[model samples]
Target chain A: MEKWRATSNLRRSLKSILNRQLSSVSEFRYLNEKRSCQSSFNLIRDCKSLGQVNAIQHRCFSSASTLVQRNPSFSTLNSDDISYFKGLLGEKSVIQDEDRLETVNTDWMHKYKGSSKLLLLPRSTEEVAQILRYCNSRCLAVVPQGGNTGLVGGSVPVFDEVIVNVSSMKNIISFDKVSGILVCEAGCILENLISFLDNQGFIMPLDLGAKGSCQIGGNVSTNAGGLRLVRYGSLHENVLGLEAVLANGDVLDMLGTLRKDNTGYDLKHLFIGSEGSLGIVTKVSILTPPKLSSVNIAFLACNDYSSCQKLLMEAKRKLGEILSAFEFLDTEAMNLVLHQFDGVRNPLPASMHNFYILIETTGSDESYNRYLY
Target chain B: MEKWRATSNLRRSLKSILNRQLSSVSEFRYLNEKRSCQSSFNLIRDCKSLGQVNAIQHRCFSSASTLVQRNPSFSTLNSDDISYFKGLLGEKSVIQDEDRLETVNTDWMHKYKGSSKLLLLPRSTEEVAQILRYCNSRCLAVVPQGGNTGLVGGSVPVFDEVIVNVSSMKNIISFDKVSGILVCEAGCILENLISFLDNQGFIMPLDLGAKGSCQIGGNVSTNAGGLRLVRYGSLHENVLGLEAVLANGDVLDMLGTLRKDNTGYDLKHLFIGSEGSLGIVTKVSILTPPKLSSVNIAFLACNDYSSCQKLLMEAKRKLGEILSAFEFLDTEAMNLVLHQFDGVRNPLPASMHNFYILIETTGSDESYNRYLY
Candidate 1:
């Protein structure tokens, strides 16, 4: 009875945590306020004139409390530069299309916008290398973009720099069923990789809300720690190795698919979470876990914050491997969710609780999972 | 009943794997031969002449097929250098004692030995920085020594380099129980940290045969992937951050306990497995998993290596989180363990199995673990 009560409290905390996370689609994560931190991408898209776009960008940057000025040192993109890129990447890959550039120039949140004039899509690593080489010698600043789904202003160029997108390089290089290792090109979408692994009776070690559009390269570059981090750990744990390209066009082939990292100086980790600053991750090798058979979820409530913390600790220690995720949200966030979305009802309407938690457990046996739940 | 039979197969394989690991203490891991690949450390200890030492070193290098010659540019330790170190550190920290040098010069395997002239024990990171800074200016190469328990020849000096041991700097800086993060100095013994975490109701992410003698610094330096790697992960995964000192006396404070790694360039990983070439790790911030309540072990047998691999994949996927470890050994290794150890008796005496396997599972409920087993 005591264990059951503790578990109930744990479930409540999870719901609360999850609620907070959902509301965190705004700029900051886990903001305590009940209000939805809305994304301004729609607002940016609604703007008509170029002057209006600048006004919106200026206002958003000002509201964010950080203003970045464009460096005067960077070279402007010229016809000669375009010719070199077009010759190397072919005419079709050299994207001067205004519509595409406008879309790619803005961030996912629509808060940050860049004034980049040209976008280059490279199908092969060799082509990406040549593009970077030419850009480097000419002192042309480049933004190594992957999917352009980044919430941060990292992917988009701040000025008239050229954008290098690796979306065309998307390819599943290899997959080892026994080891559950997947080696893929930088541009592979997270959703595609997830689907491919699902077919193989394995799952990617990570799953996030942005899986639909986020590229595997962007995920690696940011070292994405998603919902499954509690179960599978971060990219640091799952990623075996990766290949990256330097500004000088040096392809650092640190990609090794070994589970055991006994090799000297794990250089790939330097690229992971670097957000393409150190180098642009070209290819990735990651270790995926096998997909389990059954999953069970529960929603419960806790009295206080301390109880929530205790419940999580108990779940981590006691539940061990079966505990996949434990998320919680405070009363305000839960109330906001109930009020904001129509047709959505509260799971626990019995009483006004301080916190709500959701606990999810997974196992191989369906019957066992249910019984355990 | 079919599940029981499969589990039975898993246990036998575990026994076989454990057998193979037991013999691996000598040298090469998973060597299928019945004969022991003995360590020559005791033999080196008995050597009376420097000529014999040279012959042993030469033979070992030649047999390994990798000969590393000493660089002539590195200056030998002199009295002035000794005086400088003594002034920088206290008199007792600076050691020219031949007896002490002999012990720190050889690895745990005794397969590799170094001829280091001086052993300097620094009490703090600052002292370590100064020592390196002086050594850098003088072009006096130095070997950073930890617990001196490394199986590979990474801990010892190749030639007459200065030995910088961090034994005196052992300290548990801080531990956050909520996060299960331990921040400790480089020289703290692995076993000691394990004990500390065990008292706090948590466990280290890794465990190995050399835990008693190995230092956490050396483990991080080599990126130690130990027995619990199947359950947890490597140091690359568990070690959240670290503090390192470069040869030019530049102290890089990358030590952070935050589980979220959104920061730029995880530079600590570069030092993790660089074997002290890039820099020497001074402090570590590692995430430790919570200690579970129940543990179950099974010894089973299988016919072939392919079956063992299949069983492991099933255990990893199906059993999921509860499956802590899956180890196996071939018949030859089993025979060797039984033949070598007098008191050791085979649990599966009924039949001569081709492969033996061991499966371990842990959970919160004792009843649940037994039921699952």
Candidate 2:
């Protein structure tokens, strides 16, 4: 009975939160306001249980000034419940106060700087699921945030959505070194994952320049493409499985590391690049590559774009499967590189060409050198 | 008038092919006797005058016989068209015989074997477009065949569809060695493209086992994923732009090598893995990578999965950014390899561990020895 009473109180607060959020959506604002007003009629009918109902109402509408003068059954909050929740989760981890809220509100792109609101830092998936279930029942919008380095405006919230930052929920759940698969929290940074894999004599199959700040969750959301796509591929190939919380607060436990499993509709692919419009990814399983025996790199200079094309054809024939990276550089991009990097000069002479390319090839077979010779 | 008569005669032969193929389908077997009676009516209608009205009737009957009969409209193809597209770049390339038809019918999987009464090999994009326009107007179901290495039943015809094999369309249209971009014909073999680039000290950005047999068009159609995807990525990343013929026989000129273009919705992505359902990709513009100086390969045996994970973490932490392929091999797969390949021996001792990993790394910087140490 105590748990039921507490849940009912939570539901009332949640409904109020939903009403506030819906009131801002232009079309539904007036409808929700009318619905809130009509709740007084229901309160009048429940007057026999008025004492319990009034206590719940008081916890929600703490200030009389925020409420309208309505039916005799309607009651107002005295002033303690709001303060109690404002202090919840403060002991478990650092909660974002007004000062820290400013930075978390905006994404890397200044395009979407959401109005800073409550930042709930969850330490475990269960806590997140619980919070989501509570928020969901009350019609609250929950936004999951990570390293927040997305080019697309997906990591940031749009309205009065509750921000559930999973940065605190960091843990390496399991890793099968034989299969080269790692299961970790979504908040895990790509740099940390790479570093961890490197120690195991393996490396994350894919890489990018934003590796230092980009979280794996954000990477999975945008299906982020990077430099190593010339070799290791995009996130679509690297990510084996995921665990996500859907919009309705249903947990999707799709954690599988098998290479080939055609059980049914591939639900994982649908959520991968969904940008959180579909669900919030809590955990991830990724396939990593083992360390290589030997590697080689080369910077090639070409007379023209046609020369680069000719070079690729010849190199693939000679290099066979050993060809790894074949990155191209236009004259403008090469010039930019030369100017930006200290002591870095163009490999080609000024009279020679209009474009440049950086090529690297690696192989476990020694015969790769014989072809190079 | 002669061309129109030739089309009318072709339509008669096509109707017979459709009827024959329909009999082979298990679902349509019930409709077999009913379809046979209509063939005689098709023969008389197919022999009508070379007028536009008769051509329309010819198409209606042709589509009615095949599965998913999509009737071609008059606006798609005019009866007065008389244009001949010869060779590409002065190379006379055309083959129209039973022997050649049999050769291009079967793909690598041998699942999608085509039985085209007449096969037309077009040498260039212009020729292909012209052929499609002419056939499309007569309501002909045309199947576009490349190296025929497709896994799905995409490159082959299910019925009496005109088979347009782009085998003779092999030609290097443009090559920019500096930019590492190559524009080539659809029928160009992957191996030949690699060889052409290799001779000039460059290489194909991607590689696979069936390099010699697979065509660039086949690669683009299926969005091919291969071993090199552990590094270079799929055809979707490498291919910058494509030229294709839409279902309505309209040529979509989308050949450009720009990396970043936010002009509109990405239309090229739709055609990449559509398996030639939407359009026929005629020309391709791809970004190629530069050649590497050298490569290093290493094989490792891990005692346990956790130690393997630790080893990868250590290597990545110690190696910094210069790391590449780290392929994990289970003992089951390793034993299979040894059993399958005659005289093949395990790189590591059998008593040491349950799994082996092959690692390779490549870099252009001259100080490669320091990374190894």
Candidate 3:
């Protein structure tokens, strides 16, 4: 019963961490204000129970007020800037409410936090250009944010830099069935794009754990590599072209659909993986590969790393072109997954091996792949 | 006999253009001097036969002296620079022989030519750093050449910039079979690496017509995209890490083997497609995919573009993961290929279709794939 209670408390703490409830932030702020003289580290040290300590630590780390100071080079937000943003994007798009600003100010990992007074939600490339232009002229540094699912502290601001969210600009411009070329607004969520492509009998060149929240713009900006990269490759190869707005608000359109165009210096590559320092990517044109018919997955136990290595080599030689994914995990990782998820049982005996390998093969010939297995 | 004479004349002209024999440059120079007053346009008009016109046109275009003048900012090469290069890299490594310099001075396309007085071959990264450090101090511009197979005149010098060839630095540093990561010197030829990976039961993520001559460094610099990109993706996705020597001689070692490292900004990407403008890439660590066993190819005829589009959709839906390549060609392309290559016959009846589609599928199971087909 005591262990159950501890697990329940831990679940609640994890839930709070994952889902940013509006009440939790205010409750945390009120509790922090009441004990203004005591530091969060001291409070963590004083906690009697492990569950209570975990919850408190989670809350303390997530709030922006308890985080480090903002960079001084950037100017603080003023009423004029807020008014200008409202005039441009409307009052609803100009977010200033403290309750809603908490999530935007914090990152997915709760590692980086910013104290921005305003967030401008742009609905179009033109709007993004105008906002960036104003910010550049006013010496107001701005952070271009998408789904805020970046592992690095790239999506959040380091100082009083204005946050320009592109989520409202989600739109699918066009798709050529023959070429498997997709042109869409950058703010479109990756999962939505995947679903859309699935319906069209195609698949995106990349897939990741954060697909549900990560936007296509963020993926291109960071040059994200994911699970399917071992098979489909990276965005640089899949993305044929893109349209970006430079820092000075000049729109650079290199959005070409042709596969083999060697006209001039490939300037589109400069914007890719630049992380928004050079410009804000507003639209993307990407090539999607056709989905195959058969998929075979095998979960195997490996006695040692050498055996895993040998198995991978054998799989490569025998499987040839059908091998899609080859992923491995150590015993410690397996144990952690098993412990965290109640439904996930280990496939092999607990003491049988130290490594687990998961191999996936996809091809047009279902029977051939099955026979090989 | 007359047809044979015409063909032989055309071949000689083509050879002069493609081969870049030591005498071709001097012959082209002499021809240009003889026709100093006659414009190439006029010469083409004045020709008596098509074969004569072709040869004259080839000569007119291939002569570097007849082209635009070099950039004036770069200083002219002196005896001191040649001596310094010879001292750094032994006498054999420093090439000043006119006959040997012809191929190095001319590009693969034979479109651009450089009047470089000296070529320095560096065998190691340390030697590259030392050469660049001296060049920077002397205010002498430098061009880093690898395979000299670039299409954008990147590998060749624009003027008197010293050529630092890295072909001597072709060394396979290491390969981790477990992770399928191969590390090698930048100067390693792409085809050679492919063969090495083939022996290990793996395949490089990229393939191109220039693979036989293009170095891995050049491929990374140009971000070369080729035929297999539809299946394997691009270099940006496959390259995990690299080592680069900056303009000021700073050796930036970012060669990491781990799949995931999000500690800071991905600075290595800045060099992936920078075309050697940012720095000289000395080494690369890339992820190679495992080779599959079963392979199937089908040549289908399409009545129209719409039918080809529908067929592609169907192929993607049915093939799923095993679909490796889906290529299309028009009747004109088919006819050209058929006319150019002997023993190349059309897959379909001549009167049947306007378009041809080639689909290739690879998987682990041979019988399953064959049964599906």
Q: Score the docking of each candidate (DockQ).
A: 0.26, 0.03, 0.18
Model 1 misses residue B60 by how many Å?
9.1
Writing each residue's lDDT as its tens digit, candidate 1 over A243-337 gives: 77666565667677887755434657756886675457889999998898888898989999989988888777766678898888999999899
Best by lDDT: 1
Model 1 docking tier (incorrect/acceptable/medium/high) = acceptable
Cα deviation of B212 in candidate 2 (Å)?
4.3
**Candidate 2 TM-score for chain A:** 0.72
* lDDT (tens digit, per residue) of candidate 3 on B125-226: 999998877776665667788999877566876555678888998999999876789999999999999999989877787888899988998888777887
TM-score of each candidate structure, all chains considered together: 0.81, 0.52, 0.74
Better of 1 and 3 by lDDT: 1
Higher-ranked by TM-score: 2 or 3: 3
Model 3: per-residue lDDT, tens digit, A1-373?
3433332333333222212211222223223333321122111111111222233457555543343333233356688988898899999999989976788888899876766777889999999989877875665767788999987667776545678889998999999877799999999999999999989877888889999989999898888888776566567667888887755565667677766433323445545665665467899999887766678999999888989988878877676566778889998998899899989998776675789999898766676678768
CAPRI-wise, candidate 3 is incorrect
RMSD of 1: 14.9
